[model samples]
Target chain A: MDRKLKEAIASKLMLLATVFSSLLIFAVVIGLIQKSRPILATHSLSELLLSSSWFPLRGEFGFYPFIIGTIWVTVLAMLFSLPLCLLTSIYLAEYAPAKIRAFIKPLIDLLAGIPSVVYGLWGILIVVPLIKDYVAPFFGYSATGYCLLAGGIVLAIMVFPIIIAVSEEVFRAVPHEIREVSLALGATKWQTVKHVALRAALPGVIAAIVLGFSRAFGETMAVMMVVGNVARVPSSVFEPAYPLTALIANNYGEMMSVPLYDSALLLSALILLLVILFFSIAARIVLLRIERRVM
Target chain B: MDRRKIEEDFFKGLMILSTAIIVGILFAIVAVVVLKGAPALSLSMLTQTPKGGYYLGKGGGILNAIIGSLYLAFGATALSLIIALPVAFYLREYASERFANFVRLSLDILWGVPSIVYGAFGFIIMLYFGLRACLLGGIIALTLLILPIMTRAMDEVMRMVAFELREASYGLGSTKLEVVSKVISRQTLPGMLTAVLLAFGRGIGDAASILFTAGYTDYIPHSLFDPVASLPLAVFFQLGTPFPEVQERAYASAVVLLVIILLTSVSSRLLTKRWSRFVIK
Candidate 1:
């Protein structure tokens, strides 16, 4: 091939590749929409979104319980993890020695890289048994080893590393001079961290938490193993309940046997996709604000 | 005691305690997996396939899953590299800032989209083609899952390539493609390799995305059309069984997966350090 022609062809091919990569998001959205159209056409949105009964065999496909379950589990997890993660991030950013920070940071990243399934397995063997043996009894609930509380606890552990990693970055982004100035004003290290660094990093920390929330909400294999895959509105954290991710993960294969079952599963997936997209965009906006401030 | 001193001591103690808890949990997870799975980790488990009633607590191994996971991760990583490299190159070398940012935002959203959604998307694609759960479906799903991670990581590395080098290459009459292949890629090779390894780790460890798309079986796949087992699925299915022995095997499978991930993570860290020695900045 001519040299100029070859370069032109290569440039054109790269552009084509970029265009293809960018279209993946649209492709997923379109695929979900097309696949879920059957359910959308057959069922009312309110019924799908509000009703709690989820009997797919009888053609009842209410996702209300799963939504509630997702919210309940995710909220519980955040409630448990947020304070600890913040404290850990604060320590890593301000309190720990450089060597400690170096060692701990990668340890946290290692925790993050551990497979979700391993977390699920640990949840089954450890968290479930603990709940069944102790925590459930204290709450006057009989634990079957798989319940919302187990799922929430497992999820809390799973998201802890993410929250700590991001929030630590946010805390670190507060210029060193700001800390020095606060310390020079006779404020203790804790006081400076609380009054100055925390305030400045608030937006980024919230973005990190939001990102963690989306991560917990979309997590599947871990939650599926622990959150008793029963589709119902739980009366207590110790009760078996189904979250959206668990629902789709557990049922998509079997749904092919029934009418609109596949659609219902796809609809759940679509809902998850939209929820994640919203949080991701929100996180990016907050991160952009942080970047502007830092720069 | 001074008020500020007391308050500082209390908060510092709390922070230390929290960090302890986090580190403690990491140790606990590894300890429990090793304690339970060590007995079941055998050479035969690494070499043989499942026998009759393996899920029912009979003798067998997870060789099928090990091989299948390798096949899927390798295939998916190769596919993702083919597309992600070009896209990363385009973003760094050609695209407008606005266009690049928009593409990055889209990639971020795709990165956060739940793995289950990918499975569902892959399942839909399979249905449209009247295809069953097979290695190909799994690879396609995993490719999508790793695409953003690999591209963004590569883009970050490529951006770190000194602009002066590119200018110098152009001054020598190098085409844009030549500069990208020879100059930019050479500078970013270590980071790119780390990204690929990271993506491969993710692809191999993920279960939800491949749950239905891969359709787990006990045998090693003979072709792209064949259904394949994976370590995660093996662990998931075995752990779900009522048999105690099978559950032990599940733990063993998890140990295998954990080891693979840790190895990848460690190697990536080493690669970054080693290759970083060659980077100009």
Candidate 2:
């Protein structure tokens, strides 16, 4: 009887633990909503989201510029990283010998493991200066070394490992028989990889890119350091811009002094949470489909 | 060259070039931090807290941040393990497939949620409780941040636990709890350790989630409620200064943080390998 009672208590405790773990997401969403209720109650959704002005001191809370900034930086990062990652992953998957693959794989993992602040330091020291001295002057822009371009480049480098790792897995998932069939049909090795392996892995590769994009969208510290925290719509890649993550990171502490400033920041956090959650869910679904198909 | 041959060679060359660029970038990051950060890394910097005007390149060290980071990461990892292990066990032993998938999807979403969002959430919770930014708050925030990661990793490890071992335990008339504790735990000991270490590395290296909730201080924290300094925040604040020397100090701090992460990662790899010998593959 005592042993049965002990088993019952253990089972109950484990169930409770699972319930608590699963409720964390709902709790975060609720906490964000409750905190931002003050602002959400006062401002219309369209005005809050659509207007470009974000002067918090004057009580203007339009996040349109930040939205545009986030979109631009994320798109630029994707543009820069996707091609490189695709090519590298293809090489690692198809061309490299086992020894080379073994050697390079861990290096990429280490790259992924480096913290964002370290990436920020590298960006401030290296990429920003390079862009400022050469790329900006060539484009006839004054070089402050902190601009959307710098942010995009830093973020691209930061997310490169993720894309490479994911895409490499996707490429490897393409059955060897697929490549063999293509090669036997008189296709070159490159042709087999491009036409057969890549096509077979298209869905997984797209999922990988989406996951990479989500990571870039939500990246805070490194992007915040390089992207000149100016709250304006950027007209050019060289122009300074403020992303949503940067806005939240830079201003959340001081905004408590203002009446509605905290609310506005909290609301932005809500929007960020919602956006990332949507993309993450979509990516998970796509990945799940791939896993099921492979099984 | 023939058209097809030229196309193939050109694309292959592009792949090689891209791979080289990626490798080059990684080396450059490590080189810049070590080269620039070495001069500033002194025994004083590692053993003492910042003195007056440390941000202005004056005397002092980042010992406070170093100790504070270890405290926070260790505390948070311990707290997460209590909840994560049980959840992992529940998912593997009790839950149905649909429910397990739902739990995994939720954890995946949580894992992808930005660290900044966790900061905001923690800050809001702090405000509601009328508590200030302190080590406790930071611990709580980081616990939330790493919980999903720990649980998922442990779940993966537990799933790898073979079924025949559990059957043998049951054949001995053992209960579900007994089988899990005796059979499953031994099998997954290495993976659990690796999961905990990975979460620790992640928690220690993160800056955004603790930025608001931790509330940096120059002194070491005396209690859980006292605000504390951390290495990532040290790097952030020092780098923000206009003085060149302080910026160099910031790089030193980055190097410190990098070394910590590298040690955790490499040790975790080694530990995983070492412990895998005992695991029933």
Candidate 3:
């Protein structure tokens, strides 16, 4: 082919690829909705989402317990990870010596690199037994190792790298000149961070936290292994519960033969996709706005 | 005055303490995985497939899962690259800034879509096509899972290729394709390699997306249509069984996975260092 024709064809191919990727999210959503039409046809959307009954074999597919369980674990994980991540990010961005910061950077990468399944194995081996033998007992509750609390703890560790990485960037993005001004005004280093850096980075930090929340919310295998897989609303941290991701992961194999069972699971996945997509988009928007303002 | 001093010291200590705790947990996870897994790691575990009654703690190894994981991840990464590279190039070279930004935003959202969603989506497509859970289906699912990640990573590096080089190429009567293929691709090759390795690591270790789309089997797959097992599912299945011996093998699988990831990350770092010298600043 001539160079011009070659160029035109290559450009068209590239544009086609771009269009394909751009439309993939829609394809996923539409495909899910189509697959899940059977369950939706039988039950109202609200009924699927709100009712707590979950007899998959008998055609009941209330996702309330799984939704609530996801909320419980995600919120609890945020509660555990946020303060530590914030503090650690603050230290890394502002206080840690350069060498320590360098050392911790790769450490965070390694933490993030460790597969979720390995994290799940770690949870089962260490966090679960610790919760069962020590933490729960100390709190005056006898418990199995697998529960909402174990899921939360494992998820907290899982989300630590994301939160810390993002928040550290946000904190660092607060200009050094601003901190100098605070110091010039006779503020302590802590006071400078409290009044200047943290205040300036609050939106970005919130965005980071939301990103972490979305990640924790969608996490599957790790949470599934530790969270007891019980289908119910967990009233306490020590109680077993099934999050939506776990519900789908645990049931996908067996659900195929049963009528509408796979559809229900797909609907649950749809819910997961929709929820995570919303949060992720929102967080990305916030982070983008922050980046624009900083620039 | 005393209160201010105390507050500063207290908050500073808290920050340091939190950092220490986070670091401690990283070490703890590795230590536990290594401690529990090393004893179970053996040549047979790497060389042999699970025998009959393997889940019953009979004589067997996870060679099936090991080979299966390699096939799936490698296939997925290659498939993702074919699409991801072109899309990334178009974003960086041909598209207008506003369009590029919009696509980047979409890619970011897709990146966060849970792996399970991809699995379900893949399964749905399989159902429509009268396909089974197999190696091809798994690759399709994982390609979707990693496509955004690879594209974004490549796009980030391409964006770093100085504007001056592109302009210079244009001055020499180079078409957009020539500038992209000859100038940009050569410069960003290392970053592209690293991104490939990164996606491969992710694809190899992920269990969720492939859980439904790639049905597990004890035997190593001989064809793309065959069901394939993976290391993550190996660990998950073994741990679910009541046998202690089987559970121990789960830890061994984890060790293998962890080592692969670590090697991927380390080699990427080394590869970047080695190749980056040829890259212009």
Candidate 4:
């Protein structure tokens, strides 16, 4: 073949691959919806979302408890991680010396690379027992280690790397000139960061938070191991509650045994996917806007 | 002025405390895994498959899971690379900036998707095609799980290749394909290696996506269609058993996984430095 012809063919193939990859997200959504059609046909959307009773054996499949459980864990995780991660990012990006920053960056990256299962193992062995013995007792609750609190704590740690990494990048992206101007105006380092760096990176910081939220929301194994797999809405962090990921992971084995059990689980998966998709898109938009502004 | 100083001092202290906690937790996780799992670590555990009553705290090893995880992750990484490489190259060389950005947004969204959702999606695909839970199914699931990750990592690296290099290649009267193959690929090879290692690490560690797709078996898989055990699921399953020894084995399994990931991250760093020495700044 001529060189031009070869280039044309190669470019065409590349485009095809790009298009194929782009279609996968839609394919996942459609596939899940099709599988969930059976359960959706029997129950109204409201009934699925609002009802708390979850008898899979007899075909009752309300996801209220699981949804509430997921929300509780996600919200609590964000509450735990947000302030801590932001402060750490601020320190790393602005306050820390170059040597210290270099040392810490890899440690955070290593933390991020640790597998979810390992995190789950650590949670089960350490965090669970601590919460069960020390934290819960102080909070006036006698509880199993596997509870919403444990799930939240594990998830918070899991999200810390992403949040700190993104926010630190955002803070660094605030040009040196801006910080210098603030300092030149007689502002202290803390004042400049609070007024200049934080304000300049607000959208990016929100994007980081959204990204962290989506990650924590979808996390399965770590949260599954710690969260008490109870099919009820948790009244407190110490209460055992079943999140959607755990519900799917724990029951996939027996999904085929019961009528519509698999469908219900797929529907729950669909719900999780849709929520994650929304947040990710939102974060992407924010990130893209920031990129454009920087350029 | 005094209040401002106090406020700064207070926030500074808070930042230090937070950093200390995060770093402390990182060390604690490794320490706990090694300390808890070392006693149970034996040569046989790394070399042999589980025995008949392994789940019941009987003697055996997790060689099946170890090998299965390697096969699954390796297969998935190779498959994803085939697609991800083309997409990354096309984004940089052929596509317009706006279109590249749009595709990147899609990839970022996919990257954030939870692994459990991918598992469910994979299960749906399996049911559609009348396939069973096996190594093939697991590989397909894990490829989907890691494709976005690999693509994004490669794309980021490709973006770092200075435009001047591309211009110089084009100035030599080289075709776009030649420029991509001969110049860009060489420049980005190290970064691409890092992406592959990163994806491989993720694919091996992810239990949720493979839990249902890769049905656990005590023996090493003899065929692509055979159900295969994996390290993450091995850890999860062993921990579920009531026997204390089996639970201890779970910690050991985690140690194995931890070591693999640590090696992956460390090697990728060293390799990136070693390979970038020849590239122009």
Q: What DockQ was computed for model 4? A: 0.85
Candidate 2, TM-score vs. the true structure? 0.97
Model 4, residue A156: displacement in angstroms?
0.2
Tell me, what's the RMSD of every candidate?
1.7, 1.7, 1.5, 1.4
lDDT of 1 by residue, A100-132 (tens): 999899999989888999999999889999999
lDDT of 3 at A177: 95
Where does candidate 3 stray beyond 4 Å?
A285-295
* Predicted structure 4: lDDT: 0.93
Best by lDDT: 4
Q: Candidate 4 chain B, which ten residues in sequence have the lowest lDDT sum?
A: B101-110
Query: On a 0 to 100 scale, what is the lDDT of residue A140 in model 3?
Result: 94
Please give me the DockQ of candidate 3 compared with the native complex: 0.81
Between the candidate structures 1 and 3, which one is better when assessed by DockQ?
A: 3
Q: Give the candidate order by descending DockQ.
A: 4, 3, 1, 2
- CAPRI verdict on model 4? high
Q: TM-score for chain A of every candidate model? A: 0.94, 0.94, 0.95, 0.96
Q: List the DockQ of the predictions in order.
A: 0.79, 0.75, 0.81, 0.85
Candidate 2 ranges with C-alpha deviation above 4 Å: A285-295
In the range A108-157, model 3's lDDT, one tens digit per residue, is 98898888999999999999999999999999998998999999999999
**What is the TM-score, restricted to chain A, for candidate 2?**
0.94
**What residue pairs are clashing in model 1?**
none
Predicted candidate 3 versus true structure: per-residue lDDT over B1-71, tens digit per residue: 78889999999999999999999999999999999999999999999999988889888799999999999
Q: CA lDDT, every prediction?
A: 0.91, 0.91, 0.92, 0.93
Error of 4 at A174 (Å): 0.9
User: Model 2's CAPRI class?
Assistant: medium
